[model samples]
Target chain A: MTVVTDGQERAGDVRLGRVGRGVRVAVALVGIGLLINGSVRASDDAWPFGPMSQYAMSVPDDASITYTRISAQTDAGTTVDVPLNIEGAGVARAEIEARTGEIVKDPSLLQQVADGWAKKHPDKPKYVKLELIRDTTQLVKGRVVGPPTPAVLATWEVRR
Target chain B: MSARTVATRAANWFTPAIAFARIAWLRTVLYLFVIVDMHAFVRDTRLKGEHPGLYQPLLLARMFDLPKPTVFNTTALYVVLIAACLVGASNYFPRIAGWIVAPAFTWWVLIGMSDGKVDHDHLALVIALWVLPTVKAGRRGRASYNDQARSESAGWVIRCVQICVIATYFLSAIAKLRSAGWALTWPGSAVLTWAIVRRPHPVGEWLLHHPWMLHVMQWVGITAEFLSPVILWLKGRWQLFGALFFLGFHAANTAILLIHFLPTVVCWLAFAPMERIVPWFQRRRASDSDAGEAEDQAEHGREAKEQAGA
Candidate 1:
């Protein structure tokens, strides 16, 4: 026998069921916990349970990304720009970004990359000349302010 | 208001609106989106860009020792995820289905996102997706307020999702400010500029010429993120405006930097008074039903009268 005073609350309220209520409270608490934890940790990797530190900082408009491009030559001897299909090799973007960083630090890896490609695809024709280039330009706006001044960092000859 | 009062109000605010119909629609759309996400865009195994050798498990995957999925495993996980999503959507063993989706979706997201960059946007949706099954069931056409059977659970789940949505922006603001330095003004601009260049939008080139615009975007973006939680405290039209503003923010983010936060947008649906639409639809249907019944009775009476006369 329940009497409504201020309010008895709704009957058959599924949220009140012990298990359902417990789950609801637990989930809400856990969500709060994660939100706090994520905020405090403040790293890119922590994710939903962590700080969403994506693009937290700014860089100069002139800040440049050292990108890798392979100019692969066809059987007809026409050279074309080839994107580094890192995912195709089962590598993550972070790993690729790291590798690019490495290339900038030590220019010698460019030859190793070219040779590895030739070994993997012995049948396919490769760029007669693979050049690791530093194309310094105003690349931020997606509109090149000037020609990509290709400063050849390193070069490797691909095996025919 | 004091902290306790605020907490009480939040609790009351989330007190389940009759959510059976509203939740049903959201759940179906969300689960289906997950299925499509796994199959098409983010398929880490057989479909799309898959690199088994390159599957570097992030902190959680490594900590939990989740399977380093091969082609077979990714495919298997995909099938299981699709089944769970379908079952959950259909409301057959919804808890079991939801349970399965949470982990499967986590796994799917981990494998897909880990390949390139791990995104925080889908994280909240994962939390919401799992908790949704804990909500009580309802008739598709019934009004949320009138439902006496298994009340409030639906609202609790929906409220949890709203909280998750808030966290996405609120926490993001905290993270940005915590590291607020020279980079906030500079690197932020550089990042967006680089992104536009990489993904060549029609307006990206136009935007590049105006470097000052980048700075304005940066400050405005962080300010919006910080203030987003205010919507929770606001009432009625203000809440609607707040919600629309955040949606616009996400839209701007996608258009400018090509940063997609689609799942977070889906979770935003929780903030909407979606239950009202269902009741409105039901009223129309009810009126149509009553009219048809009246017409039938009138036809019967006319026939009876004519027969008596004859």
Candidate 2:
């Protein structure tokens, strides 16, 4: 009876020891994992959870991106490339088609863009590049070199 | 211990001011760096381009058609506030610095919030800074980078900072869970496919043309993000695994995506118990810490002797 009791006690101790080792190993693994997880997710790059890619992801397809050139009326009309953002890809395609076609179909738009550019800069005439970053909105940038102050504009449809 | 005794002990030792300063210092530096970068980009880009309108810093503004200066002015105000906060972070003049910085930072962020893109990251920083001004960080200099003097709030301040740091992962995990498609599509493959279809980098575009690579990448991304939270919260070998997963994921993102903010992401590793990072640092620095400390103590002892002789 005494021998049997000693054997049983030894078995119980062994089981407890194994369980303790397993728990320790599991704990160590968890701590290491947490450190790693925190490091990668909290970076400051890619605009650090701001816009850039996020906005780019949201932009819809079928937006127009066009490129055009405008002529300044003041100081002997000089031709320059200008960019504009129209509503849709179809509008951009239509404008391009109209430019190549016999009659100037969208005279009103061309004149409006030209007038807007002319008003923004009084000192020198220049050209602008407008790209559609999103639907219904255009990004316009320009540079004017010397007199004759010509404005050339171009546009392109945004892609999603 | 009894709850009453515990409360009394805590009250006797607790130093709110020092705790506030430590977190304030950490946040102010981080916020300042981000704002400075934004300011530099805006200032430089505006000069080269005709309309300052081309660069929309955040998309929330565009959705509502908010005024142009709405974005610019708000960002500029943060830039100024961050500068003030940095001074506050230095542990100089707590009452004045704390009062001014807390409101200034909050107001600047409020303007950013007025638009749609109220980033959760900025929200975390605001809370950290706001709570700090109420603490005694200014008086004790416990939070100052150069000050080694332990303050009354040091332990509790550290504990709170640790909690805040840990919460970031918790929130990110919740966000991932909310975006169910991430798990369903698998982030690795989905992100790869998305990148390829949209603005494909040279390497990503090449890989996309091969469907096998795209499929593999997709699985990797999903597994990393989804399982990461488990490892992060556990804080041992698990934390190491989590870090490795993040490093791999971020490296892949950096390689493929034109997005440029990985450095700040890696800094979050500071929250890991120093026990783990210490061994790694020890190999590089060897006896540096002991030698430096010994030198400082020796210098202090000499100063004391000179005073005695005088």
Q: Which ten residues in a row have the lowest lDDT in candidate 1 chain A?
A: A1-10
State the C-alpha RMSD over the true interface residues for candidate 2, after superposing those residues: 19.9
lDDT of 2 by residue, A27-61 (tens): 33454354334333432121223211121121112
* Fnat computed for model 2: 0.00
Cα distance off (Å), candidate 2, residue A76: 13
Candidate 1 lDDT, B208-251, residue by residue in tens: 77766866787777888878878766656777888888889888
Query: CA lDDT of B230 in candidate 1?
Result: 84
RMSD of 2: 15.4
| Model 2 misplaced regions, further than 4 Å | A1-160, B1-28, B34-79, B94-99, B106-123, B138-143, B146-183, B230-241, B244-248, B261-310
Off by over 4 Å in 1: A1-23, A68-70, A83-95, A101-134, A138-145, A149-160, B1-18, B45-50, B136-150, B181-191, B285-310
DockQ, structure candidate 1: 0.33
Q: Model 1 RMSD to the real structure? A: 8.7
Give model 1's docking category. Answer: acceptable
